[model samples]
Target: MGYSRLNVVIRADASVHIGMGHRVRSEVLAEAFSEQGAEVCFVVHASCADFSKEGDFVFGSESEWHELAHQADILVLDHYGYDAAAINALFQLNPNLLVLDDNNNRGDFNCRWLLNPLSLRYSETVQFPLTGGQCAQLRPQFSKYRAVNPIGQQKLLLTFGGTDPLELTLPFIKSLFVKGFPTEFLLIMVGSGVQNAKEIQDYCRQHHMECQIGVNQVSELMAQSRFAISAAGGTLFELACMGVPTHFIQVADNQKDALAEHSALGWCSATDFTGCLPKQRVSLIDKVVESVLKTWQTDLTQRSQLARECVDGLGAWRVVETVLASRLVK
Candidate 1:
């Protein structure tokens, strides 16, 4: 079952507003497809064209999407901007449509398959054979860097997605300092879309703390960190794969349900800070930092074990095998 003849076209986008989770996960699947000898191409929005590779396509209109779909053997869509009508139109162009979704909130999808790695719940109407965190698409680096003993250094990794649209990094770091958390142990990762990177870098320098902007080797950092304070997005699953105990925060409306679900599963702890007033936000941050310090003092063996048990770092391979095995691939 060589995939040398198959062509996989992935449609996703990233920007300062929407973040890079979609593009990152799409790349994970793309790598898996490439490993199987499939020809992979990315179709991103014009705003994110700068991030595209040599053979990638930048599409600005729905008609442009249809044009790409007409040529693809399998069109993998991971964008939130597409509506049910738009998805159905792509299905008309090519029936082998695989939609990567977070939630099944959209009325209905006429695609051949749907993959949602965050939630386990599946609608009776839709064909959601692939669900749950086991399907979480993570890069191969995470598996390679997975901590064997699940015990890490004293450093605490902090990431707020690729954009940090709410601008939570500096305020959160400041809150940690004000809450008596040691500044020397903080390892801040500033995303490419973070508008206040200069300010954050200056603050880190003044405090003599470490900060990295648009880092490529994130798995190396995660492998060395004892714990993390991350946004409730794809990074949570990545941390889980690395067996890092994390306290996650919801930064967007779409992340709310997934955060709650992951918390209930004991994969990670939650810190509710969204939609708070300025004064209340400060209070919540102080409380969360205090709680984090307390949790750090205790043994995190159970937390790490639970996280690793849920995400085994083979999700991308699982998804690739499923897609290649499907009847639609022909």
Candidate 2:
């Protein structure tokens, strides 16, 4: 059952437009595959090349994908840009194709296995298993940090993915200030993709607040925060693993359903800002501030407990096992 001979190639991309959630989660799964003795490589777009490791391939053409598909024993794809045609082309090269999906809105996939951590619906076309937050691929630091009590200072950790494509960081902070929220209670973590990092840093400095850009030790920051306001993406699962009561904002169309599901489960508070104008967003911020305060006052402890119970921080291993099991059966 050793995976030493297996060659797993993960294909994903990150940029200011799409954010880095895809690449981040793919790395978590890649780490699990590597730990199981499998050789792993990432094939990413050029825009994301700067964030990739030394041996990672920066793909530019279809021929490059064909070459990777031919070489890979199992091709793990976690990109949203690829349609069915692109996937089918890869499946033709290697039958052992595993796709990491969130919304399952790509019509149909030609892969051997399809995994959606947000849902557990049966699929007739491909094998779908371990479909829940229990399969969320978070880094090892989250689980290690989870062992520590997360009820630290009353500070709020704020992040909006790697890009914050919507530019929610400064606006959110300004709204908090406008609402008379304690300036000392904010710990802003700006993403590398954010174009206004300099401005955010300056604003935080002027207000005597803390701000960090492109931090690798996010778990440490989460451990220091009793609550959080984050975008509804992979970070939600990570915060859940850390047991930080969070209020998540929907910044994308695909996040709508997941937000509703998590909210219904009492894991976190949810808000939708997908199509709001600048003025409307400012108004919505008032509602978000109210919700954050209400949740902090009413059910912070319960939400934290529910979130921790939802994701145990071992999902990457479970996914690796599933892939290994498939190889064994084959």
Any runs in candidate 1 off by more than 4 Å, and if so which? 123-128, 277-280
Weakest 10 consecutive residues, lDDT, candidate 1? 119-128
Against the true structure, what is every candidate's RMSD? 2.0, 1.9
lDDT by residue (152-226, candidate 2, tens digit) is 746788898888888889988987887777878889988877888999999999998899998998888988888
- Alpha-carbon lDDT, every model: 0.83, 0.83
TM-score of each: 0.93, 0.94
What lDDT would candidate 1 get against the real structure? Answer: 0.83
Q: Tell me the deviation in Å of residue 18 in model 2.
A: 0.9
Give the lDDT of residue 57 in candidate 1.
Answer: 84
True lDDT of residue 179, candidate 1: 74
Candidate 1, residue 86: Cα displacement in angstroms equals: 2.0
